[model samples]
Target: MTVPRAMKSTMFTLDGRRGVMLACMAPAAAFFFAFWLLPTARLITVPAEKGWSAYFEILTDSRYLESILNTVLLSLVVTIATLVIGAATGIYLARRSFRGRQTLLALLTLPLAFPGVIVGFFVILLGGRQGLVADFTHSLGLSRVTFAYGLTGLFLAYLYFSLPRAVASYTAAAEAIDVQLEEAARMLGASRWHITRDVWIPQLAPTTVACGAIVFATAMGAFGTAFTLASKVEVLPITIYNEFTNYANFATAAALSIALGLITGAVLFAARLLCGLSPAR
Candidate 1:
């Protein structure tokens, strides 16, 4: 079969494009397979004698089970809190054009620039004993209101980092939407309440979910903030670290890591699915 020159050239171009795409993706794929997949494989596919029994033991044990519950609770609470605060701030910023708006936005984003440890340190200094909150409480004649090394402390610390990320995500989404939609709703005799409930919220729902997922992941993997604020708290990350470092149990640590990874992966997957299921705007 004799092929036309143009058709042959088109086929060659398609093959070249595929090769280029694969080349572009190769580095990322290689890194993921080597660093991420390999470690995950080692964690999940080791020591056949122990088998799934290791996983079962961790899941069944009361202490590890409690750690799972506590970690999930913290992640959910912080995700919600960050979403609300960030969404409100993002909406406000997106809706208005004003003096010092840029300054305020930059300041809000400053936390994003700070290292996790630095932010954790400042959180300890600002919210812990002799810190701003503690000072205020002391002056109120209240008995030493402590917000250190506990769930409360961890929640506060998580918000410090999560808020900026949520704001960044939600702000991009909010900016993508047009203000005229609200104006059009107003012209249609829809009140502010109606516009918010019917228009803004539905439009923002997917973005909100995205922000929540990011915040959840941040809270899940956070170490420095959790270590400083909730060292005694037995969240999954801390548990994994303790098992690896303090107890020197690589198998248990690997098991914990796998469990944590599975839990996080499942939640993120569900969140992404929910995002996909959202009605097209």
Candidate 2:
């Protein structure tokens, strides 16, 4: 079989392009290996240094178990709240246009600009001992109210942190949905409830799962807000930090880190699979 001369040249050109692309990516690959991959490889093997029983011991510890539970519950709550409220707001914003709509959107997305620690501070200002809630209740001749250092504050801070991402994702998903489906549903005598339940929910389900997984993962691993809120905040990240920093228990810390990562990664993987994506994708 005779190959065309142009085809031969094209194949050579393609090979050259592939080589160029690989060369361009080599620095990044080296940087990732030096900065991330090597450290992660060492960290992943730290449990074996403790004779492989380290993970079992860490899991058996009541404090570690409680921290893991608390982290999971908090993350689940934050993800659910973000999804529900964010979905509604996103759909509304996508479907409606009014004065100051852009302003409202800006305000909605403004939380993304604030880091977890800053959000923790904002929560403190709202609910701290000498903060707005305390002052308000004091003015009303009531007892001082504060929750800034508690689980409640942590939840609020995480929700605030996760909400922006959910809203942005949901808004984009909602906007990308074709309106003609809703019109057809309406023409078929579908009520508002029917249209929403049968049409909108199905359309937005993928975004819900994907965004929920991201929010959950973020909350599961968030440390800055929990740390800033209080040293007493019982979450996995804080536990890991304390083990590594305060106690110098690197093995325990590594085990805890692995556990947290496994849970978060499992959730993300399940979500991707549920949304009909392969692991390669």
Candidate 3:
């Protein structure tokens, strides 16, 4: 039997397309293997050279355990606080227009331009000794209240960066919500609070959760701010730094890094799953 001309053409076209796709994928595959896969394998295995028990010691050792708990707690608190504050502000900004609205948004999101170190410095200037708050309180003959060197200061710095991201995400999500559902609820004699509870909250929940996860992950691995304030704070990132640089404990540092990475990755994976199940999706 002779092959049909159309069949030959179809096969040739498919083969050409497959060749083009493989060619396009070759660089990415090579890069992933060279950079990500290799580094990750090394990170996972290096700690094993000290034995698997070293990984378990992260949970048993008081110092490492404290740092882990501290980082997790701080990230969780920051994520929750940012979502609460950011969702309120974002919904208002998305729903209403007023004079200076643009300016206000610009100011709120201005922190996005700042690096982590800059955020730490900004926190210090707000609450450090000789900071504005300290100076004002002292001028009033009140005892100075400085929190710049502690967990409070680190929390504020994390909040500074995380809030902007939350606001941006929430604002975008709010803007996409259909106004008709809210209006329909109101027409049925629903109060503002009722409408928000019954209509808006459900719609926004997934986006809020996903944004909170991002905030959590960012807070978990944040190094520059922690480094700037390390004298008073002992987050996991700082602990890793100390182990690697100060103590030259490569195995411990690598193990701690892997632990942090795993936690962040797990939260992010959960966020992605939530996003996939979102009503919007």
Give the top-scoring candidate (lDDT).
3
- Give candidates' CA RMSD values in order: 2.4, 2.7, 1.8
What C-alpha lDDT do the candidate models reach, one value each? 0.84, 0.90, 0.91
- Residues 1-281, candidate 3: write the lDDT tens digits: 99999999999999999999999999999999999999999988889998987798887999999999999999999999999999999999999989999899889999999999999898889998879999999999999989988899999999988898888888888999989999999999999899989899998988887898889999999999988765776999999999999999888999999999999999999999888887763
Name the candidate, 1 or 2, with the larger lDDT value.
2
For candidate 2, lDDT tens digit of each residue in 204-249?
9888989999999999999899998865568998999999999999
Ordered list by lDDT, greatest first: 3, 2, 1
Local accuracy of candidate 1 as per-residue lDDT tens digits, 106-155: 88988988777877788778777778888888899987666666888888
Per-model TM-score on C-alpha atoms: 0.89, 0.93, 0.93
- In model 3, which runs have C-alpha deviations exceeding 4 angstroms? 141-144
Identify the runs in model 2 with alpha carbons over 4 angstroms from their true place.
1-8, 277-281
Clashes of each: 0, 0, 0
Q: Pairs clashing in candidate 1?
A: none
